[model samples]
Target chain A: MNKGLIIAIVLIVAVVLFMTQSDKKEVSEPAMTKAPPPVQVEPSPAEPAAPEVSLQEAFEMNRAMYGKGHSFAWNGEQHTTDHPEEIEASKEATQANAEALLASAMAKNAEVAKLGFEWKLTGDILKKAQQSIDQGNFQQALNLAAQAKYHARIGIEQYHYAQANWHLSVPE
Target chain B: MKIIKTLALNLAVASASQAALAADSGFDMQTVDPEADRIALQNYFKARFPETEIADYVNGIYAVDAGSREQWEELEEFPPYEFDVEKGEELFNTPFANGKGYADCFENGGIGIRHKYPYWNKDEGTVKTLEQEINECRTDNDEEPLAWGKGAIAQISAYMAWTSRDKVFDIQIPADDERAKAAYLDGKKFFYAKRGQLNLSCANCHVQGTNIRIRADLPSPQLGHVTHFPVFRSKWGALGTLHRRYSGCHKDSRSKPLKPQTETFRNLEYFQSYMSNGLVANGPGARK
Candidate 1:
């Protein structure tokens, strides 16, 4: 009876210890190893790679995101708009992509001007995005950079259309 | 020689076909009657706003919008253009170093002569505006010409407009001048041509969009619009010429404005003024 009682007590203590260690591991996890936090994502370099998506996630994300836009025609007039929200592989990737878009949009300055459109408003939005980045509004900044890109693209098309119309009309 | 003959035959056939199509649709401007255009244009305006008198058309938006007209009448009490008019009169009367003033450059000593502007200059073979004549006047007297859309030009034009007050527009496209007719047609084309990102034309706003609220603003009828010149716009915070207003319209439509007094603009003025041929000058007008 005494031996059985001692074994039961020992098993109970071991189980208690195991559970306590598990709880400790859960509590002490570095945020990087866990899922990403909501907005104001400041992903550190030390973040562990997400187990679900690995080698081809970036390409897959882009392929899926870039093709998500839709177009429709109403009353004989065709209308189109973009999907501003993108499904990025990671918050850091989203930031990096936004930076690239900003650079490319800025580089197309001459092309935009040639299309007879000025980018003053777009440029101002870009400045605001930079300010947002410095002020820790990374997600907002990304959205704004995307808006600027959209404006630049639309401006280019409008410029070309106006230029063609002028040429055809005035021929001067 | 055989190939040339075949090409010539094909070209002649193509020309005949095009001419036949034009004849069917009456699509050519070559023989358009300016007098007919004026009558039709005035009739259209009169038919639309039956209550407004023919002469009152020169008052522009005021002839349509009673509330805005009341405000304008009140503003006219102090008359926002008074200072500019005074400055312009001083400038007009001031002689150049050679003792020649603007009066020396024009017939009738530059007074009561604004109605005759934007006329076809037979020698120059181009349309000339009041602004152009002012510049010519200055240059002839060995003085520097003012920038076309600048405040100084507007001020001078304001004084000229005031001097010619109530003189009905007498724009004439001489019977024999095809060049003048072509210019007039081109101006009409410019007015009606859809342009810019907004896909707007001068006609779209002033004709079709008249009395339609565009975010709390109404476009006035195109008739008699040319009667007003060097208008004091609250938005501009200063006097602006008719071309300046036209340039604003261009910019508003997201199109780059051609420089003031370009052949395109002068021709545009020639046709626009001709449309309101008998409306008296109601210029140096003030507006929001």
Candidate 2:
């Protein structure tokens, strides 16, 4: 029994000693292993990267708004938005559309002063619409634009009415 | 037994040492190109909105003309042009129902802390932005996270940017570390990811020429986007956090909006800031 007890104690002590020494050795080893150098990422170039737009969406939206090989037509005159040469042609068409309608209204009213009042009101509404558009208030601008369109329509209607009904002074 | 015990000890020590080294070698800012960035930015804004008085409105809109470090410092006292800075400041200190404020969750209430974004957790292989950082803090403290575009996150972001006004940005994405690289890659994927009914990606309008049709404008590319964030938008009539911008972009693209500070957005912010490294910080800017 004494021999057995002694052997058991010796074994336990040996195990403990081995553990302590091993721990020390392990602790010291990491100090020697240098960490691997950092991976170097190649810096991306400075200029902007390639475009990321969905080609389909761009193509479709463009096609819908300005059709493929489309032409802009006003008052039996044809023009193209894509062509700078046709810009003047389009602008003149729009102006003529506005002017012809205005002339018809003025002819019906016969009173030059009344026509002047309507024009002034139309200008005032357009100015407000432009101001709102510049301010990024899109909803407000939309409302103002609608109002201007309505007034312009009324101006044309009144011009036609005066031309048909108003008495022209027969010149001596 | 001794050999096995020795092996375990060696592994533990190795990991601990590795951790220490990783933390020590933080980010390096020397690689950032300043002049190229400036030229790109100048070309971007000039080509897009040339009719506007960009130079005059640089303080609010254009990031370039917002002045040097010294100028930003001086403009600090004045409320940023469109943001409700004073209101944001008041809200920053206000405690939530859980009896905690923003200071408890962040270092220095997140002031002048615009960089080091889009961080990833290698263990999870995921990314996080500043907004996500804030929300995580809130969750840890048992407080409800604020909704995007409204409430604390937006206000706090505005206030943080305002306080950080005029410092140059220096975001770092660790290339050497496996984890850091994953975060950056994830961020890149997000920037390019396309979604929504509009079927648009964040890169679509911001990266593509969609800005071309609306006006002479094209959205600024990802490069140099990090510097001016948490801006005061004229459309909102209030200061907006970076997270708000993310949500707005998502909404604009017709995608379901992500919560403010969500992990996905945080990673995106990290990637974005990384691109704009070395640009002067002009947070709390007024934008159209």
Candidate 3:
């Protein structure tokens, strides 16, 4: 092609590409911000095959899995309490844990409840203080807020202690 | 009839070989001892680097203990003694134009970190994983956050995890605060939220019906998920931050991926890590 003709063609092509890109951006900008349509995907294949285990292998695997999980029931139950001694020990431990958790939870509930009451009291105090202040008693209101702040601090401490105890009772 | 029987015999042998071939992958179902998985990780490393002796300093923790003891001491810091820590330190101090540093947000020079992670934020009513915490600090400081896979966040997370060696994770998200309560609730929801092509939630395998097969084995819920972020995974063939792991889960779910440091993932990390409280911190762990 002649130089002038080639240059003219190149310029036209560049203009066309730029126009197309701008058009695409204009079309896409609004769609970008909108909520996307729900996507429907094809279902996946069935699960991969499990390890082929003989009966003995399956039993051993189950035993290991159960052990890792700390599932200690043994009477045809979850655990391997094949021995009478294990059963007795497990039961005793379970009972102890249950008692401890119950006691701890009760204590926690009481502490948290006390804090909740304190918070309520603080709110009431603040309201009364606000009324007093509106009536031009700044000193009384200030005193009331100080008391409310004290109550709030106490509530926080109580809540923290209760929660800590609760945490201690529950094993990870 | 004779030809048909011969063909049948050949087919049977071929099928047996194929079955054996299928079972030959590194992870096999019947032989799955967690011990075996541990050994596989070892063999994989040995095969990858024949010269190096990767030492097992702590239980369930592995590191390349090559060179003299003094030289290995230098290697203890991750990114193989690169500008990783320095860049991380600079990134740590270089306050994004928004005027913030790691010290401003977290405790312990931002060291002894990972303790307050995976926290339930009752205010935002969501769990905030450590990754989310980092992203929160990054964004709050007016910086475009680092990508999760193998960048600044991973570098910093790795560095912090190294600094926090042998420390037990002790997160404190005040449940009494309304925000903390909300965060815990949201985190719990995320834990139970099912997604992916498999339609599995973290709780599905980790909690309820654990030990069911995905491929070989899935670790149980109690195995300290948060304690192993910035993990050097065999599957990934590279070091990755928790958010990268999150993104992998999302991709596995076939869900639209959230941005690194997005709220949903941060909350997910919070709930996941909360489940792993009391486990000793073991970040940048080598895993399959």
Candidate 4:
């Protein structure tokens, strides 16, 4: 073969070999790296994993949280007091706090009711709480109010969970 | 070239990760397709109860078990709601205080119209149920609106349903109206969404839990649920409308019941009636 022709042939063969190798790498590389990493679901803080709190536990928690006049937050509002002594010194002030808690429970119940997720006992419990208040039994009223609030909170959580997961129950 | 390859690989990996996340979340917000849903629901029951005839579903729990069906047939021979239907017929024909009566307001003097409701009223932009319209008819003619759930309302509904016996439900969600579609979707959401302290949806019992005993009673299949209404339940010992049954179910599930003829319930009836599209109306049924 002529010298120039032989050189050109060599270059062509080399180029074809390189192209073939590149195509092989392109096909095989994605396959090797295509295994998707396992997805980790971080439970939303706003959403409860399940309705785990019992009525008794909810009442006790509310008693500890509100009975001491300890400051706490719920539904994005801060329920607090600068004067703990004022709460302790005045029986009327304590009664007011109990009434306030009952009102809060009512508001929460109404929120869930709009979503059509209100529990049957929530309204009944709140009514009893109001009755207790009417009878001047502040402690009993507070307990019932706490229980009602618990039901309302759980209902709200259920509403959110259902919004996201309801389609799973749909028959395929 | 190496940089380009790395960028491509990274894009592929990111896409895969997003897909995996979506699968793990299992979040789906699908558009409302009533016809598709109806087919799936009917097919589900058919597959679930292969022996039960499709037409027999209007019989509810009795349709599932042969023993119960035999007893139900016996009960049917001396149907409990016969008296209610007769009273309903009288109430329906009696003229209102005004010169006009219920016959004046509806098509075909309101006979054989049970299956036509609960319909979407385009002008009202809401669902119009048979019971609701009955009350409206009374009020429109200078008469008092009847009490919902039971009593006169149920009696009237029973007479109307009797007139509609063997007529299949043909509820419509108008194609041109967004409100009608929204109402149906809302209702479907209500049916599937878990509520109350028990965390139970309507589907939990009637759909997935059909034929399964809950306490002493077996839950009925959701298919053809609306076919039989204004039932004379042995528990009540009186005739009651479908909303009465809905209220009872809510109480059973520990959820606060919505009032009868309310928007929520009217929409629910719209969805359920649509689901029972092909089934024959067999209302004023008797149940234990």
Candidate 5:
């Protein structure tokens, strides 16, 4: 009587436990499924966007690079030279800078009128960029713009650099 | 009271140290002696290039480069600059709209005066190039100043330089005036100063690279740089003033060029011309 009673009790308890465990699994599966899709979507595509940046952001980065770029070739900021669109933008910025500098040079004295030819070269390069754009040669446009920007930057630096360094060449 | 005495002692020591520092490292102004510079410069070129005749120095890099010189001499026979000289003569003799002429503002009727230019104007406290003088002459006569550095001004300069052939450069620095000395010194500084994106000075080319060649062109010795004005270049296919050449060089170095006749350019002209004191004027010359 003791052995039969013990066997029956064991079978009954095992069946009950198994049933409860299966119920729990069934209850948890849909909840887990429903919760995951949107959450997974949110993080993978959203926050630590490591690989890519927008064009505007890229341009800002470029500006920072040229303004404070790490290359010894530039004052630290290497202009956005590698990319066509960014180079085009940089050309406009440089042209504006050159024009502003030219005006400033003029205001100090009307003698700045003499630098018309240098500024004309900037305009000519810009024109070349436009032609490149018309020809759908964006890379060529970028190259031209890059060259124009360099000239513009140089033009802006011309008067001041001369003023600052001319005295250094003075005989002691 | 003790603090006051300590402060007073510190001040005295500071003054003494500063005085000593100044004595050791002062501003160190170089006295302007154009004649001495001319002699030294001549000796330098002469000693460095014993084969080159002193008179031939005015011929620029050609004087030292026989290969380029042989080709250059043949080119000079026809002398493409002839048209420019003729045009310049006409422009020089023409009167301004104000009924006054260029002759009215210059000595010797503006003829044979290229060697006398880039003079330090004692009254103006600035240097003036022949280019500047030509513009000034026009402006003084109620005509607008000619555009210096190129074009018509260069033509007039070409004519003037041609007419002034055989005349020696005679740049002066008044020994009594400290400003003149400062101008000359400043010009020298500019010549030697490392500048631009390339960090080059005038000396980098004219002084050091005179014996060297880049591609096909040789940098000429600085001895007679001023004797050639408004040179006709094969590359330009047009005449260019020395200042125009200066601007181009600066641009090549990734630096901006100052306006023509600015104190910087003028002072440089003054200094360079002074160094070329005895070189014969052989401007309106040709170059490749």
Candidate 6:
């Protein structure tokens, strides 16, 4: 209650109030200020990504894996690839070559089926190939038979791949 | 340099421990451990849906989704499979041409023997399914065998499944028979192997993709998949055997479906049934 003490207290209170206000202003200053404008980045011009391999190219690559004289072996039976060369030599699709191709396809499909990895479309394709043969469309038949054979080969490959890698998918 | 050496030592130790842990937990393709696989699979679903009871897995998709469960419960009140069960019962009771009925062929008069199916026949050296056995019974009795996939075979299976309502799956892979173990392993391989143009395995949908919607359908967990057999699916609009469903799944995968009761399928059933060993049979089920 002394005059000097009261004056001193008032001055101290004012100082504290001033400091509190200053602290609040400092805390809120960042929020009140505008954020920096977003950076405008121009994407660098670059060459377009290379296109993926075409289906025909992929098919040719797959076919190349089985060399000219390759013999497909399954269940103790070996199916030689002389039919492709024979067809190529004939220059035109022949019933004999078509039948041979179908036989090879059937052999491969049987192997795949035994493994329980036969593709659903393979049988239908084989059937279509047979129908094409019946209709004397030997070229179409040859193509269909080759497609079926391709599917069967893929199925066999899938089976082996699965055998090797199935454990990788098993939940730990 | 000392810090780097210490860090390297820590890394090596950490990696060694990790490898040890992986070896302990990892499933061996060569090894046939049905119980271990079952436990791991069930645990997966349990961890995935902590709220769900293990026994409730028999409900299939209903166990995961509440919305579907409510609809299913409502459907169960007036079950669609009732007529098929009745038909199955009649067929099961009818005597063969030789005066021996299906009852004469089975243990316990075929009342509640659905859970013990896809057993390895040691003498025959093959996996024998209920459906296969039923046909065998017919042939033994001088009766013509029923067709494979649907119709009478499915009906009879449904009746047998109905009789086995609460019986838990108890498929056995005989420890003495290496062939039985091989069959199981083969089935396991088939289940895990990615097939067809889709390149998807059974585990991809049922195990990893459970409760995850694909288009309009929700793939159920694999834990209790075999519990419901000869199910009356809304898609089918009639009861169909488990093999029939297997064929459908194969078709969906764009893989050629093997004929019903093929050796491969029998093995698959053997593996699947073994996985559901602890889960109760709740077949002759109606599903959407």
Candidate with the greatest DockQ versus the true structure: 4
Q: Residue B281 in model 1: shift from native, Å?
A: 1.0
lDDT of 5 by residue, A11-130 (tens): 999999999999998788876574544443334645553435555566556666675332322332333424332333444434444343334333422232243224435555666766
Lowest summed lDDT across 10 adjacent residues in model 3 chain A is found at A163-172
What DockQ does each prediction reach against the true complex?
Answer: 0.02, 0.01, 0.01, 0.27, 0.05, 0.20
Candidate 1 per-residue C-alpha lDDT over A1-172 given as tens digits, one digit per residue, 9 for 90 to 100? 6999999999999999999999999789987777865575555779843434432353345446554344543333443333333322124535566666556556564466554354445667778877776776777777777666656666676555643442122110
Task: Kindly report, for each predicted structure in the order presented, the TM-score of its chain A compared with the true chain A.
Answer: 0.42, 0.30, 0.29, 0.47, 0.32, 0.50
Report the TM-score for the A-chain of model 1. 0.42
Report the lDDT tens digits of candidate 1 across residue range B41-148.
Answer: 677667668988978888888998898899989998998999999999998888899998888888898899898888998788899999998998888878899988
Q: What CAPRI class is candidate 3?
A: incorrect
For candidate 6, the per-residue lDDT at B136 reads 94
TM-score of 4: 0.74
Task: List candidate 6 stretches off by more than 4 Å.
Answer: A1-104, A136-139, B1-30
Calculate each model's fnat, 2 decimals.
0.01, 0.00, 0.00, 0.64, 0.09, 0.43
Question: What is candidate 5's TM-score against the reference?
Answer: 0.60
Q: For model 3, how does the per-residue alpha-carbon lDDT over A1-172 read when each residue is reduced to its tens digit?
A: 7999999999999999999999997788886676677685554557543335544455466656664224443223354412221222233223343333233333433453443323334455656755655666555555554455444444556445533332211111
TM for every model, in the order presented, reads: 0.62, 0.44, 0.41, 0.74, 0.60, 0.73
**Candidate 2: misplaced stretches above 4 Å?**
A1-172, B1-83, B95-100, B121-125, B193-200, B208-221, B255-260
- lDDT (CA) for every model shown? 0.73, 0.52, 0.52, 0.81, 0.69, 0.81
Clashes of each: 1, 15, 16, 0, 13, 1
lDDT of 2 by residue, A25-123 (tens): 778877647466779666476853333444444444555799645654443345443322122123332334334333433343234224321333444
**Candidate 6 lDDT, A131-160, residue by residue in tens:** 999999998888888888878887888888
* Candidate with the larger lDDT of 4 and 5: 4
Docking class of 5: incorrect
* Two-way TM-score contest, 5 vs 6, winner: 6
The C-alpha stretches of model 1 lying farther than 4 A from their native spots are A1-68, A71-172, B1-27
Better of 1 and 5 by TM-score: 1
